[model samples]
Target: MHKRLFIPGPVEVREDILKKMSTPMIGHRSKDASKLQKSISGKMKKLMYTDNEILLSTSSGSGLMEGAIRSCTVKRAAVFSIGAFGDRWYKMAVCNGVQADKISSEPGQPTLPEMVDKTLATGKYDLITITHNETATGVMNPVEEIAEVMKKYPDVVYCLDAVSSLGGTKIEVDKLGVDICITSSQKCLGLPPGLSICSISQKALDAAKKVEFRGLYFDLLELYEYIKKKDYQYPSTPSLSHMFALDYQLDRIFEEGLENRFERHRKMAEYVRQWAKERFALFADERYASNTVTAVKNTRNIDVSELNKKLGEVGYVISNGYGQLKDITFRIAHMADTTLDEIKGLIESIDKIIM
Candidate 1:
């Protein structure tokens, strides 16, 4: 039986979107490739709510996350962690030999605006990275509030990891003063994994020019300049398959209407969160709960593996908690093209099995 995915990523792709991946190969250097990429960029700008230039990479969202930190941090970086993914960003900075400090919040909480204001007040860092939505703990940072705090420090290059939230929620990159906003095809974009995308501000590009040893392949400056020079062609042989699917998927997204899509995700998330509260309890604070996924606390101490096995038998699958919270909490993702009715169905199955 083919189980429906209720996990965070690699979400259920529509049959039509899946077929787009099989599109005929195109020369990566050809003008056709440039046209296709340019078309995607124009649509992406509308989706991201930014006038900044768009960059696409064949690797996962981590590729751009690493690139943004390595290329834009001229002095040092302050990474705010609301959960596992945020910590991973800090680790990427460390592994790249970039000077960085990790400031973490307790799990199930958010990286508050006050935390950002206090950290930036010291003037010790020139770059800051914030995870907009964390799948592990199902916490969504308050980017609007944080954006207000960010305005206090004009020189800081603000990098945001919207990998799991971008398409599911509204993230105004330009209004938030985000120098780089990164996301992947797998999560809320309703596409298969492979390509990662970002909107890079002119400020970020200028910051990258000052860094001397920014790595070659993931170099933001190199990628930016080449795309401008070659008219949207990537320095590396891009993932034409994913590009085809993404280009088609963006059109589908438009047809659905962005506001309608976001509202659908919001309704699904609210339903799941209410169900969790009534039964198992929520792991993250309700005020900061995510619109894409909900982390339910396992108050009943049910065997999560067994529950997943039962769900699989019923043609559905969810996710176990991530990292330290594993088994203590279970996550039900409501992003991508999942409808409120489908979310209710998954909850109904779980209720039948557990109760």
Candidate 2:
């Protein structure tokens, strides 16, 4: 049986979107390819609410995350962690031999705006990275509040990992002063994994020009300049298959209406959170809980693996806690094209098995 995915990423793709992948190949350097890419970039700018230029990579969202840190941090970076994905950013900085310091919040907590303010006040960093929504602990950082703090440090290049949140929520990248906002196809975009997308501000591009050793393959500056020079074509042979699917999927998203899509995700998240509270405690703070995924504390100490096996038999599948949180908590993702009715059906099935 084909099980429905309720995991944080690689969420269920619509049949029509999946079919777009089979679209015939086109020459990556052809004008037709450029037109296709330009279409995607135009639509993406609207979705992200940014006037910043768009860049697409064939790798996961991590590719751009690494690129943004490596390309823009000429002095040093202050990396803030709200969960596992946040820590990953800090690690990327270290591995790249970039000067960086990791400031972390307790699991299930948020990276407070005051924390950002205090860090920037010291004037020790020129770039900062924040995870807008973390799937591991199901926490969504308050970017609007953090944006206010960012305004004080005008020189600091603000980078956000919106890999799991961008399409599911409203993030005004320009208003937030985000120099780079990164997301992937696998999450809330309702497409299969392959391509990652980002919006890069002019400020970020200027900062990248100062860095000397930004690595190849994931060089943000090279990618940005190449697209502009080549008219929306990538330096590398791009994932034409994913591009076809994404271009088509963006149209579908528009047809559904962005506001309607966001509201649907919000309603599904609320329903799941209420169910978790009544049955099992929530792992993250209620105030900062994510609208895409919910991590539920395993107060009942149920065998999570067994529950998943049962769910799989019933043609549905969710996720176990990530890393250390495994068995301590279980996750239910409510993003992508999942409807409120579908979410209710999944919850009812779980209730039948556990209640």
Model 2 regions lying over 4 Å from their true place: none
lDDT of 1: 0.94
Measured with C-alpha atoms, the lDDT of residue 3 in candidate 1 is 97
Q: Tell me the deviation in Å of residue 295 in model 2.
A: 0.6
| Residue 156, model 2, lDDT | 91
lDDT of every predicted structure (CA atoms): 0.94, 0.94
Mind sharing the TM-score for model 2? 0.99
**Candidate 1: clashing pairs of residues:** none
Model 1, range 1-355, lDDT digits (tens) per residue? Answer: 8999999998988889899999999999999999999999999999999999999999999999999999999999999998899999999999999999999999999999999999999999999999999999999999999999999999999999999998999998898899999999999998999999999998898999999999988898999999999999989899999999998989888999999999999999999999999998999999999999999999999999999999999999999999999989999999989999999999999999999
